[model samples]
Target: MRDRPQSDTRERIITAADRLFREIGYQKTTVADIARTLGMSPANVYRFFSSKKAINEAVTARCTAEIRMRLEAVAASGRPAAERMRALLLTAHQSVLELGVTDAKMQEMIAVAMAESWGVIRAHIEEVDAIITRVLRDGVASGEFVPSDPEVTGPCIRAAMMRFCHPGLLTQCHDIPRPTVEQQADFILSALGHHARS
Candidate 1:
């Protein structure tokens, strides 16, 4: 019963941190800011999270979970491989753009994660890759996609999508619209020399 308040406090801290990270970015936000947002003291915030980096990691994990959920939903839909792949790319593209453009805090948090929280970023990438690999394998087994090594194909597809989805890359290449999932799917199919639609 005593643990209940501690659990609530932890959750409140995490929630406040997530919202601030999405709004003001990780680099710009301080522990005091989060504590103020939660109507608590900076010392109280420290009791839950020792450092700003720790809070960033928690926020990143939450965001990555959301991304995985969205991807899983798309994968679970009874769509063809080509359509599913396209949907995945579009969804990822939109997510990145939304994070970078509309959610400045999230973009800053991502930058920090890439620079300081590499382990967290790497783990998230691996999880996302595993999901994509499973989806590709399922598509092949169901005869919706051609035989291809998901181990190789999954990482390659992810890398390509990451390049297009990267905020810095997109900013530099603003004149060019990011490729649709259909275009990326076609490229992958051509590389595999198999009809993803069939």
Candidate 2:
């Protein structure tokens, strides 16, 4: 019989690693732990991943991929661009919120991912920015937004919504109740030169 596919083994490693990260967190979880979960030796795990950090990066990528899929559907929807944009921003905030930032174990995992797996996180940010840019361009084309440079405007929207999107900020700012994600989305929509229906 043919040996197991390398990609299958790699995905198994990532799936096991993600479950472990959620259970024990990034700092406490180790290669040995992941290997044992897979009923393999640590040396076997090493054959697929160079280090725990690499495994963590894969796990981070998987989590962010969840958000990306939702954002993509929002961006591609047939609704007016401004409305889609509002939905997109709120969707992003909700997606990150669903990642269990309140759980101490998941919180520690997020903190470590932000600190150690920054490149993976940064790529996720860049992809999100691209999605925002797409909506900006769509709004401009439809006269729903003022003509502006999307490259600059995209990141600005991301920065403006950082409180909702960032893991720590969601927890830290939860007590301050003035501006909900809906309010922020409206503010962003207005800033895009959109006038909501009366």
Candidate 3:
């Protein structure tokens, strides 16, 4: 079909851009570099992505997709809210750490995302919040947690876990070693009114 090549070309562009970002950092990698790597013209790259920012957004979305899928799986599971919430938090933290964002070049890309293409990062955070909200609502319905406003708690919980979840902060705070991921997840669960079994 005609659509398959276009999809493949777009994926190829995203793949090349991600590689360059890992090799040379996001601030330094150019569309021309991506095109050169693909043996395609800059105009062809533009046809798929209108600008370098577009390419950067695509690459970022691709990188974060795996983490999102992991979180989504935990959210959609049929476990009790308290257990699901704990698993979701743990999954979120572990998945982000596994993403290798602390690497110098990956950190550079994250820094650029924070500065230039914040919408992409914000979308990811929003997705996380939505998953948390879904779990919290189920927790309330199941009587596993107290009735509370998920909208308020969702982002609050996410902010509380930012040190573990945020790529940039994760690297900076890894050395302090005070509140481990397990402790934080338990703290957040307790704060949500989950009483651990004896």
> Each candidate's TM vs. the true structure?
0.83, 0.93, 0.93
| Local error of candidate 1 at residue 102 (angstroms) | 6.8
C-alpha lDDT of residue 195 in model 3: 61
Each prediction's RMSD to truth: 3.0, 1.9, 1.7
Query: How many clashes in each candidate?
Result: 1, 0, 0
Query: For residues 32-142, what per-residue lDDT tens digits would candidate 3 score against the true structure?
Result: 999999999999999999998888888889877878899899999887888899999999988888778889999988787778888888899898899999999999888
Worst 10 residues of 2 by lDDT: 189-198
The lDDT of model 3 is: 0.89
Candidate 1: where are CA atoms >4 Å away?
1-5, 22-25, 101-106, 178-181, 192-198
Number of the top-ranking candidate, with lDDT as the measure: 2
Tell how far residue 154 is off in model 1, in angstroms: 0.9
What order do you get sorting by lDDT, best first?
A: 2, 3, 1
lDDT of 2 by residue, 1-90 (tens): 547688888999999998898888777888999999999999999998999988888888988999999999999999999889999999
For candidate 2, the clash count comes to 0
